[model samples]
Target: MLTSLEFRLLATAKAAPELRHRLRDHGHDVRLCATELLTNVIDHLGEGTPVTVRVIGTAAEHGRVRVEVTDPAPDSPPVLRSAAGWEESGRGLALVDALAERWGVDVGPDRKTVWCELVGDGRADGRPVSGAARPTAPARGR
Candidate 1:
């Protein structure tokens, strides 16, 4: 499923339920990651920017869901960085990293899409599979 909307304060509120409905068991992770990505677009690109949110289900038996947030700024890719405890922000992507099986950015000529995949199976706990080899570098696509 795909939704296109302007990134606003209430955008997440509206998008969350839809994502939950589409993602089913993986709703929580998808909602949180989508929120973080939308928030990033609003914070960095300014509010009211047009963005597209996509949720795709892959590997149904394993409960894998992919979430993608596409924004108009191709040059302003998201960067994952360490945030001091004193800081109030900058933890969004870190939270995404912890929850997602894998995440990456895809840049096009005019826009960029930040995406993450979450696997809902293989762990009794909702967290990602233990000892899974997560990529140290962000995956980028043209």
Candidate 2:
């Protein structure tokens, strides 16, 4: 079974308590990205939303996790808002755009899903995906 985005957030939080730690160590800023994405889907996209999460790669903790938050609002897919500063609202997708590795929408007649994928660094055996995410050693003698 695959883990939900909420559960993934919790697991990442447990694995690395600090936000920077989660981002740098994991090679994917999934926590903040997921938060913004889900919030956008819930607040603006539609009500009674259903989000689907998928993890694909070599293994559980070493793969690309794509999160798709589906909503009933089909006509309004996510769009980038180019608003001036000091605006009353907006900017979720903008932040998502800046943060996510890749993000887009899957549109349908009666539904739409805004999806984002965060590729893991794949550090189960001490080697990172691109030599950028070196795994931190476990704390000893608890």
The candidate that achieves the highest TM-score relative to the unseen native structure: 1
Angstrom error at residue 27, model 1: 2.2
| Cα TM-score of candidate 1 | 0.69
lDDT of 1 by residue, 1-142 (tens): 2122222233344555554454444456777887788778877887667788765544333466566788889999998988999999899889889888888998899989898877753223454422222222244532
> What's each prediction's TM-score?
0.69, 0.54
**Residue 32 of model 1, lDDT score:** 83
Candidate 2 wrongly placed segments (more than 4 Å): 1-28, 45-63, 121-142
Clashes by residue pair, model 1:
none
Every model: Cα RMSD to truth? 8.1, 11.6
True-structure Cα RMSD, model 1: 8.1
lDDT of 1 at 16: 50
